[model samples]
Target: MRYFKGVLASERRIRCIEAEIERQQSRLALNGVEGGEQVSRTMEGDAMERGFVKLYDFCDALDTELIGYVEEREAARRTLDCLDDGDMVEVVYLRYFEGLRFPAILKLLNAGGRNMSERKMYSLHEQALCRLWRVIPREHRQRKSVQ
Candidate 1:
């Protein structure tokens, strides 16, 4: 469970970093001179270098965290077929892996539920985590084994 949460948090951090890089790239593009090709080339190169650094950091973080997370998650997934519908899995993927917020999830799902607040969303997420826990083998659930 801790591993799952850690994975989710790491993924969210990566997405946030990527979004910042995108915003920076857009700013860099817009700030370039309109007609001077030479000037634009130099600016673009510098911007790309900066963007690369940000992207590299994000990728490194994702790679490091995702390595173990994926292995454990896959192993757990294969153990039990508790997940009947793919929606729960999809929600987990989007919320954790893609770093989407609850409102974004609601919009994406197009499910009408004004009363389905963030608390409910979190509860559902916890349920999913529990399901994953159940799927994982007892030995695998040990702290040292997961690490």
Candidate 2:
């Protein structure tokens, strides 16, 4: 569950960083056009350079976050694929990958002709996680042994 949650968190953080970068660029562009600050040329250059430095920092952070997100998401997907139960796979996929809460998961399941209660969905989620935990260690050992 923590692993799955981390992927979602990373994705959200990346989006926030991207939006901030865009805002900073827009503000810097507007600064050039507005021409109302009435500061010295050197001060203006300093401010602009600082803004770009912040933007570059954000871009670097975003690149790092994106790389981690892709690797984590792929590992999570591979783990999910190891599960034999389609229902369990769907539940995990919707909750983690799709970032849906329990209520939304319930709604989608029911819409797909699954007449399941919230409690049942919760139970299934627990079962899926339990299975995932068991599978992960075994999968890890298998890879290590092969190498």
Candidate 3:
């Protein structure tokens, strides 16, 4: 579950990196523009071409990683769906997808004025986890994640 949340964070990081890459590329493009008084030499053009190629390769790699993160997140959500209990599902989903802490989840779960104790909350969490492993099959649990 932690892995699922980490994948989301990695996606945000990839977006930031892509923005930086675009900024760098725009800077490079501005640099490529020849001054009105001067013409671009062959050697200078070649250098600019080489730099853009490297940037293109980097951008392609980042795009691939972003796709991988999206795929992994979907897979984790499917795994979470395997649980039979709605409350259990909510606990796992909120924990992983929303990145909420246990105390926060406890508050959310207790919103109906049920007045659940901390110990009971912990017990519910534990039971949910136990059921999660038993409910999800071996192969599903072994699926690889990019995070």
Using alpha carbons, what is the TM-score of model 2?
0.79
lDDT of 3 by residue, 1-147 (tens): 345556568777787778877776776768764322243558876666666666778788798878887887786778766677777777778777777898998899899776877787777666766666654545444444698
How much lDDT does each candidate structure score?
A: 0.60, 0.81, 0.71
Sort by TM-score, top down from the best: 2, 3, 1
TM-score of each: 0.39, 0.79, 0.59
Q: Candidate 2 clashing pairs?
A: none
Top of the candidates by TM-score: 2
Model 3 — which ten-residue stretch has the worst lDDT? Answer: 32-41
Please state the error at residue 6 of candidate 2 in Å.
1.2
- Residue pairs in clash, model 1: none
lDDT of 2 by residue, 1-147 (tens): 667887789899999999998998888888782333444559777798787778889999999999989998898789887778888888899999989998999999999787998888888898888788865634333222453
Off by over 4 Å in 1: 8-82, 111-123, 136-147
Q: lDDT of candidate 3?
A: 0.71
What order do candidates take by lDDT, descending? 2, 3, 1
Model 2 accuracy (lDDT, Cα): 0.81
